[model samples]
Target chain A: MLSIKNIVKQYAQHRALDGVSLEVEKGSIFGLLGPNGAGKTSLIRIINQITAPDQGEVYFNGEKLNPDHISKIGYLPEERGLYKKMTIGEQALYLAQLKGLSRSEAIKRIKYWFEKMDMQTWWDKKVEDLSKGMQQKVQFVATVLHEPELIILDEPFSGFDPVNAEIVTQEILELNRKGTTIIFSTHRMESVEQLCDSIALINRSHKILDGKVKDIKNSYRDNTFHLNYSGAFPAEKAGLFSIVKPADSENVTVKIAAGKTPNDLLSYLLPSIQILELKEQVPSINDIFIQKVTQLS
Target chain B: MNKILLIIQREYLSRVKKKSFLVMTFLVPALIIGMYGLIAFLTVKGGDKKAQVKVIDESGIFAGNFKNNSSVNYITTKESLDAAKKEATESGEGFVLYIPANIESDGKIELFSTKKAGLSAVSNMEKQINDLLRNKQLKDAGIDPATLKEIDPDVNIDSIELSEEGEKDSSAGAAYAIGFAAAILIYISLFIYGAQVMRGVIEEKTSRIVEVVISSVKPFQLMMGKIIGVGLVGLTQFILWIVLSTTLTGAAGKLLLKDKIDQVKTEVSVNEAGKTIEQVNAEGPAAKILNAIQTLNLPYILGCFLVFFLGGYLIYSALFAAIGAAVDNETETQQFMFPITMPLLFTYIMSFSFIVNNPDSTLSFWLSIIPFTSPIAMMVRLPFGVPAWEVALSMVLLIAGFLFTTWLAARIYRVGILMYGKKVSFKELAKWLTYKE
Candidate 1:
């Protein structure tokens, strides 16, 4: 678990994070959603202790974040990097050791991860010899090899193909299921929607939205219904509900009037129109993200 | 501490294992020995090339007067001077020496050749002619040539240096050579190893692995680790070079110059009559050099060298590391490098031009004491012998300077490594210095 309280970070002539705060619950896939240059990286860096916050405190598992907690946190930066001249296994072992693992322990975990990722043959291959996606896989293995209690992955899926992305997604889910807290920072709203139990959407220098995905979606919802019907839309009863889209070629979209219910509208329409399909439209996290960002800016 | 050690180990091993490191380690000593071999060959054998002289002695008094040595051969001809000149030109083989019948009064001689004779060849011919005329004059004056030889003054000035211990034979030339060599080694190693640290920093930054590495260890730890690591590599190479060069050159010396060394012994004994037995018994130029080196107190000088070597490397490499972190790539490093490397470059030039010549001057004293220039400047003075307190003070200041620069560099490095795609100015770097950890 991680808690960032009133985190304020500033670079020269620019405010990177302005009083942004968030809580990452234990054993949850916490999505940190933000646009480019949205202070997400600044916040993540503060949490990782790569840089200190000018005016805030970060607590990891109820203790103030200190150097000792470094071993308990794994960070995979967006620009996935490995020493090009070093072999995959050598670099991985080095990284694992830097995380406070013993040499034998690091090797054991590295072997396990390399096998899990199907990278056994790549142990001796130099990083430059590997494809970008392959390097990403190696970086991924390195990130989780120490089995940190909390993992911070910045744009973890950027260089991955769909297949690898799915694999990484499954790995993240599996890690979470095994009681590991993950802080996944990305702009990929679909993954956030798919994997995140909770998220904090940051825009510019502020956290614009924070909550469970379903609740946030429900909070933005209106009583709008999408109808697929091949029938005459009764012109006189149109005043009962405002038509968001007119009945054109077997589809009608409308928002029900405040005093009416969906059953009442259906009853009123049953005589004139035979509905093929009627369903309430729930906004995807992608739409809500776009709408919220556009509104805030 | 453990993490820093780990980082140092990784940095050191990664570089030391490189093929370039191995190649340079073995190849440089071979190349240096090869170069010295060429010089020795040229001095011993190239100088022995025979030059044939065609002599047309018109003076009957000078018949069969010229003598031949290893470097020059004289052949008397009965042909006329113009005919000998023509023959020499046509043959294109050697000079034509002509002595006129009025040689006893005018004491003049001439040489004609198709090509210009070497200065040594001309001088050798002059000496032979001068000696022949002198002997003839002495005989005419009724003085014996043996008496003239006995009266010849061959005064040898034995330069014995007086020090606190006692009078010891000293060669200023040898001291100059050793001091200059040590200073140059420090100067070159500082640049070579310091630049390597800078390039390593830039590699980690450009590769974006610095972030990953720093997250586990402090920036200060990482920077110190890299500087120490590269410096170890430099030290290892230096030690290996010393060992290899000495061994190889020693073997080559025995193989190529066995006769040359014996010749030096005989040459030394020939003119060393009035000197002490110690001077004559020193045997040869090689043994004298060995004595000079021994008198220089090599262990003390080497101790100072090791301290300043690491100290200088630590100081300069900290700056280089900071510069590397401040820039995005190697090309961008130039703008930042000039100010940092100025002290090093200035001291290197001054070590050769000023310090070596005036090791005891007030300027040399200050140059050797200041931390920035001391590493090289002190080396220039070390062979001449520096006071103990001055060396101690310089070393302490160097350590202080190293700590200060490393602290300054660490501040910039932590912030700079994460920054990308921005043209970093001096002002920007100053701002980074003010940034929080």
Candidate 2:
């Protein structure tokens, strides 16, 4: 388990992180979502021990984070960094050793990862000679080759084509399945919907929303319903709820007013048309994200 | 400790494996040997050729003044002076020595060549004329020529120095050569390798690789690893160069001298005569230099040279590493590097004075003890002698200086490695020095 509690980071006249906190359970993919400059990087740096927080503490596996703890955490920073002059295999092995793996162990792990990623032929090539996507693959291998207890990937899928993105997505899931807790940070809500078990959303240095992926969506529910019927609903139904859009066919989506229940909405719609289906449509995480961010803005 | 060792091993292997290192290691020594060989060849070839000149004496007093030589064909001309000058010009070979009538009384002689006569040739001709005049004076005094020749005497003086151990020392020329060689080695190594450390740091910082590496290792470890690794590379190259150049120069020297045995014998005799002449000719300059080198303790000089070289390099390299970490680019590095490198330049310039005034004075002791100036200053004093206690004290202080500078540099490195785009100034660096974290 990785726990970051009440971490506050201030840089002179500006407050970068304002008492932000989040938890990532073991063997789960946790999404940390925020708009640009939302203190996501600051929080990541603190967790990675790149910089110490002004006032905060992070615990990993019941012990306070320290230099010793850094060996057990694999971090892929948002801004990609690799020594351009170093060969791929050499760099991978070097980074693995720095993460506390012995030489033979590092080589073995590097070979295994290279074979798995089908990057065996690229082992002897310089990083500068490799394309951006290929470099990202090498970086991914380096990040997970040590088999750390916790993995933090920031914008891991950026600059990747769809094919390569899918490749990384599969690898990320495989690592998570192998019992590595992952903190995945990105603005891609679709990936969160696909992979994240829970998430925290920060806007303007404040976490406005966080919970289980399903629960957060459910919590932001406004009793919106999607109705499909044979005939038109009553004109009075428009007065009972805020009509989002009325379809040209006999289908419409409506937001029920405050203090109004779905039962009331259904009762009002049932008598006005031959209803084929009247389902309460739960909003997607994307909808919830935009709605929450726009409301704060 | 293990990580530091690992870093050192990687640095060493990676650099040594480079083509640039391999080329320099082999090429530099070859170049030095080739240069020396070229010099020896040119000297031998030039000495084999002799300049030929013809002489003509006009005045009866200067008759028989010319010396006969196979190379220089002396011709006696009874024609008028204008005819002799025309003959000399037509011959296109040698100059005409025109001695005016009663030249001994006038004390004036002239030489006319198509081109200007060389100084050595003109002096030789003048000496022959003076000898003839002296002989004429002897004949006029009614002295026998054979007796006058028998009474002429030439004296030669041989120089020798006794070492403290009662051994005859070699020529002071050899000692000066050794001293110069040691000084140049120290000078080149300190600047070249120290700049290498600085440039390495700047490359890492500019590329932002320091960010990732520093996350795992302490700044002190990184700095030490770089300095030690580069130092080892330098030592390796130096050893290789010494071995290669020694072998090549020895081989070339033998091959060039192999067929010139008779010439070598003659040259050796001439060299001995020349050394004797130099000792008697130049007053006491050669003897003073011989005494200076022979009286000094050789072992102490070498030991102090090694200590000061290592100490000064470490101190300067530490400051370079700090400067590397402080700035983001090479342009910014210049602002700091000038101040750091000034001491080295200053020490090299001031070294000569320290060698002359007092090799064991308080000033020399202090300069050699201080790590910044020790590399050059201590070396200058070593050619002269220094006390054992002074050498030991200087070593202790230099080591201390290296440690303190390393610690200070590591402090700046810790913060500077992470800072970016925030142009760090001297004031800011001063503040960073006080920063506890």
Candidate 3:
């Protein structure tokens, strides 16, 4: 669990984070969604204590975020890398130890993770010998090797192939299932939709929206429905509810007019057209994100 | 603290384990010995071959006056100048030395050769002719030639250094050599290892691993760890080089100069057999050098060297680290590097040309006291025996300078490491210092 309050980060004349506040519930997958340069990285850096907020405080697990909290949190920056000349096993062990693990413990965990990632033979290979995607996998393994209470990953799937990305996604879910909190900042909205229990969308330097994913989606719902019917569509009797789609199509979408429920549109269309499938079209987070960002601009 | 140690260990081990480190450690001493051997060989071999000089003493007073040494041989001829010139030219083996009948008044002599003669050879011939003429003039003036020789006695100055412990022999030349060598070593090491620190920082930044590193520890800690780590590597290599070079050069001396060593040993033994003062003085130079080396306070010099070397390295390497962080790559480093290294370069050159000779001058005193130039300037002064308080003051100032520069560098490094693709100017770097963490 983490709580960030009124975090303001400034860089010379540019403001990286402007009074951004958000709470992440315990054991929840929190998606920090933002466009490029939308201050997501600045906020993430603040949470990880890589840099301090100009005028704010962060609480981790009911305690003030201090250096001791560094051991309890793991961070994978968007621009991640490994020492190209160092062996994978040595590099991983060093990184794990830096996160406050003992040397032997680091080695043991690295061995386990390397085996799990099917990188058993890569222990002695230098990072330069690995492909970019392979290096990303090694970086990912290093990120979670110490088993921190909170894991912050920025664009974690950028260099991973589809299969490896799926594996990593499963791993993230598995880690979360075991009671680890996850905060991922990414531009991948579909992954955010798939994995995040709650989401915070930041625009410019401020948080525009945040809450349970379902609640945010529900709030953005415009009461639109997609109807697939066999009978002739009623074009004239649709005054109470406006048809969002063109009138000639067999499968059409409609929006209920103000002060009217879905039942009103159903009753109006029943006599003329027998509705086979009536599904309320909930706005995807992608659509809501674009709409919200465009509206702010 | 543990994380810092980890970072240091990685930085140190990664470099120390490289093949280049091993090669440099061994190869440097060998190259140095080889270069010295080459010089020694050229001097001895070239000195062994004597030049043949055909002296045509038409005045007949200079016959049998010239002596043959290792580098020149004299062959007197009685023929006319043309005949001597024709014989010498036909043989093409030596030069023709002509003495005119009125040589005493004119004090002029001529030597004809196929090529320009060596200055020492020509001067040797002139000295022989002059000595014969001078003796003849003395005899003409009713004075004994032997008495004239006795009047012109050889003089040698033995410099006795007065110290608190009493008077002892000191070789100013030896002291100068040691001081100059130490200053040169410090200068070279600063560039080699300071640049190593800079390159290490650039490697981390370009690889984008610094962010991941600083997330676990502070940026200042990372910079310090890297600087100290690279410094330890330098010290290790230096210590190994000292041991290995001493051993290697000792073996090489025995192997290459065996005959010379035996000759010196026989000369020393002959002196032990009741030789005259002249013979003893003939062997005094070698013994004087050994005595000078023994009298040098080596432990004290080495101790001061280690302290100043570490202090100077810390200061310069921190600035080098800042330069590394400010730039995107090695080529970009040129702009920032010049200003930082100017004082060091200026002091290093001055230490060789000016400070060593004038170790007690006001310029030397100030240069050795100021932290920016003290490392090299103080080293050049150390062999001449610096006062305790001056050294202490210089050391204290150096430590303060180290801390101050490290603080300045950390400020620049923390912000610069994170900035990507931005052409950071001095103004921009200054602005970064004002940025909130």
- For lDDT, the strongest prediction is 3
Summarize candidate 3's per-residue lDDT along A1-297 as a digit string, tens digits.
Answer: 799999898877778889999999999999999888999998888877888999888999889999999989989999888898999999999999899999999999998998898999999999889999999999999999989999999999998899999999999999999999999898899999999999999999999999999999999888888999887887734558777887555688888877888898888778887788999999999999999999999
TM-score of chain A of each: 0.96, 0.92, 0.97
TM-score comparison, 2 vs 3, better candidate: 3
Q: What's the TM-score of each model vs. the native?
A: 0.92, 0.83, 0.93
**Candidate 3 chain B weakest ten by summed lDDT:** B273-282
Give, for candidate 1 chain A, the lowest lDDT window spanning 10 residues.
A231-240
- The residue pairs in collision within model 2 are none
User: DockQ, in order, for the candidates?
Assistant: 0.76, 0.35, 0.81
Q: Pick the candidate with the highest TM-score.
A: 3
Reference-based lDDT, each prediction: 0.87, 0.77, 0.87
User: How far off is each candidate at the interface, as Cα RMSD in Å?
Assistant: 0.9, 2.4, 1.1
Q: lDDT per residue, candidate 2, B153-219, as tens digits?
A: 8653434545465755444444445555676678778888888888888877776567566667667
Q: What would the TM-score be for candidate 2 when compared with the true structure?
A: 0.83
Give Cα distance to truth, residue B174, candidate 3, Å.
2.5
Candidate 2 or 3, higher DockQ?
Answer: 3
* Candidate 1 Cα deviation (angstroms), residue B17: 1.9
Task: Order the candidate numbers by lDDT, best to worst.
Answer: 3, 1, 2
lDDT score of residue B123 within candidate 3: 69
